[model samples]
Target: SQKIEQNSEALNIQEGKTATLTCNYTNYSPAYLQWYRQDPGRGPVFLLLIRENEKEKRKERLKVTFDTTLKQSLFHITASQPADSATYLCALVSGLYGGATNKLIFGTGTLLAVQP
Candidate 1:
């Protein structure tokens, strides 16, 4: 069985510091890993995607590292701020598209609270 878990508690940090979050999983052979950001009731917005063969990926102030050996992923937000406060989700891309779109399985999420 495949399972994913993210820190459910809110992470409080200073505006200029880095915010790090963890994602753990068990029993899943996922094709690719993805990260998304969700604000309140809004749907998740894609952040970064890293294939199984890739060790790390980054965009702007965000960085993600995937360790298949550990079955875990880490997300980092540099220069955090109140505007960066939101819930971050880690997902596993599962199933073949059969030439169509792939399906993604998302974890609960970790709420980050960045202080100004």
Candidate 2:
């Protein structure tokens, strides 16, 4: 069995600053990790995905790092603005329960609030 967890609390930061969120996992070795952003009443939008062998991945102002050795992943947003305020989630394919379907299991998610 594998479990995923993200910061349960909301993060407050000033606009134009950087926001960093963490994702931790236990009891499984996933082939990759993914990050997504979700607004209230909306489904999560895919942000980035990093393979276990990849150290880092970047897209626009977003960067994601996956460290299999530590069973953790980090998601970063640079030059963040108030529009960036939303809930961020980390998801991974469950190796134990996901046999051939490769089901995705998501973390609790972390709320980010960028204040101007």
Find the candidate with the highest lDDT and give its number.
Answer: 2
Q: Residue 40, candidate 1: how far off, in angstroms? A: 1.1
Off by over 4 Å in 2: 96-99
Error of 2 at 101 (Å): 1.4
What is candidate 2's lDDT per residue for 1-114, written digit by digit as tens? Answer: 668999999999999999999999999788999999999999999989999899999999999999998999999999999999999999999766547787889999999999
Give candidates' CA RMSD values in order: 1.4, 1.8
Measured against the true structure, the TM-scores of the candidates, in listed sequence, are: 0.93, 0.94
* Residue-wise C-alpha lDDT for candidate 1, range 1-108, written one tens digit per residue: 678999888899999999999999999877679999999989999999988899988899999999999999999999888999999999997776464767788999
How does each model score on lDDT? 0.91, 0.94
lDDT of 2 at 1: 64
CA lDDT for candidate 2? 0.94
Candidate 1 stretches greater than 4 Å from native: 97-101
Error of 1 at 32 (Å): 1.1
